[model samples]
Target: MAHGEGSHNRNSVEAGLEARGAELTGRLIKVVLDGEALHRLSALQEADRTQAVADLEAENEFSPLSHPELESVLHLSIQEGRMVFDIRDSHETPLMAIVLAMGPFKMLIKDYQMLLDSYAGAIAEGREAKIQAIDMGRRGLHNEGAELMQARLEGKVMIDFPTARRLFTLVCALHQKL
Candidate 1:
């Protein structure tokens, strides 16, 4: 019984160490949105642009446990009307780079923008019903964008729904800059 207990304890310690190693390697340490890609966002109305910047800087946790190859720093940019994801390790060595065509996202983004404009107008006009309806549409479009992003990234990277939503926001911010 004593020998069996010793073996079990050793196995537990080994498992703990493996888990810790995975945690350490499968975390995103930083995320950078390219300055050139952010130009469109800067063109937004002052208040809207400020809010967009704040949203980008908000705390975000990224876990690539499902795709261990992606456990690293991430940089986002837009090139030739496409969203580019450049992933790098802690040492700044490039891991993988993926470019997603912006075409598929155009309609959803446009709809979201329209909804935002409508919602703002409704707010200014003091129409609660219109605001609520527009808000619902905005959320629905946002979710759709996130789902499309997740689908586009399938097999390349794994991200949670909230992460996908935030990524969609970033994409919209970049689109605004354009």
Candidate 2:
């Protein structure tokens, strides 16, 4: 199997992950359909890393797996800050729009609300549950913050002098819900 650049090479990718305190492993696979090339490389968990590989045909096109498959793909393991998939793909290039066209944008917004709901549930549980509950509440706020960040990342929204006020109001509303 051949390896690509940008955090995919076995040694470099693992080294990068180690620097960040996450341990990961690499797998390089070259798929051939009747001897024709269909390249696939996977960096999986050292133990049963095979679990990390998903069949391209089995997942929804809008799901992260297929989303990357259509163009070149990349998967980022958030916990590690290391890309599990290719990092080179991008807009105006071989970049596959995250097949979430149904809309991935809306789904991201919905995810933010889901996180808020999770926090609300925790808050209602009681002060005896304070430690864990507070943690959940913090995560809820984080989710909303992440949503705003993702919106800007996807170019679905942007910030300037005027938008900050609206953003502030949005945060207040979400906090009230929590």
Candidate 3:
């Protein structure tokens, strides 16, 4: 094959891959933690609460692997000792509700809560040095939690690493800090 032809073929392949990726980018329009979950997440300071939600929604990837075309709003709730992912379409039509036992995530959630409290305290006190270190720990925990989530949802839902991290953060927030 001519060198020019080979280059053109590669470009075509790249374009096709990009198109396919777009198809799989199932967006999460909103994520709501049901009221029964928690009254307040004291680990996060009052001021940063709103921003945290914004951060999660800013750039998240969530699509039911089984239904990539179904963009959704998710309602998370704890029911009967399990976490429920109540997914709905744009029109508020139900898509699927996945219930997962929280046992697998118990310890991870506790660790995340501790990190959040430490991180929030560091920020509030203007302890710049501590802030970076705490954030590093937070990231590590988030990565671990995300990996666990991927394994747990392997065939049911498709959430990229970042999305899983954000969702896990929210779950930690749902825990009533003691």
On lDDT, the candidate that comes out on top is 3
Model 3 lDDT-worst window of ten: 1-10
**Residue-wise lDDT of candidate 2 within 75-127, one digit each (tens)?**
32212221122322334233332211212224433554454455456556654
- The TM-score leader among the candidates is 3
Error of model 3, residue 73, in angstroms: 1.2
Please list the C-alpha lDDT of all candidates, in the order they appear.
Answer: 0.64, 0.30, 0.70
Q: How far off is residue 176 in model 1, in Å?
A: 2.6
TM-score of 1: 0.69
The alpha-carbon root-mean-square deviation between model 2 and the true structure, to one decimal in Å, is 19.7
Q: Which 10 successive residues of model 2 have the least lDDT summed?
A: 30-39
Q: Sort by TM-score, best first.
A: 3, 1, 2
Worst 10 residues of 1 by lDDT: 1-10
Clashes of each: 4, 2, 0
Across 57-154, the per-residue lDDT of candidate 1 in tens digits comes to 45443434344534477787778888998888877788778899998999887877766677778888999999888878877776787778777775
Error of 1 at 1 (Å): 52
Colliding residue pairs in candidate 1: 40-176, 40-177, 40-178, 41-177
Off by over 4 Å in 1: 1-25, 35-37, 40-71
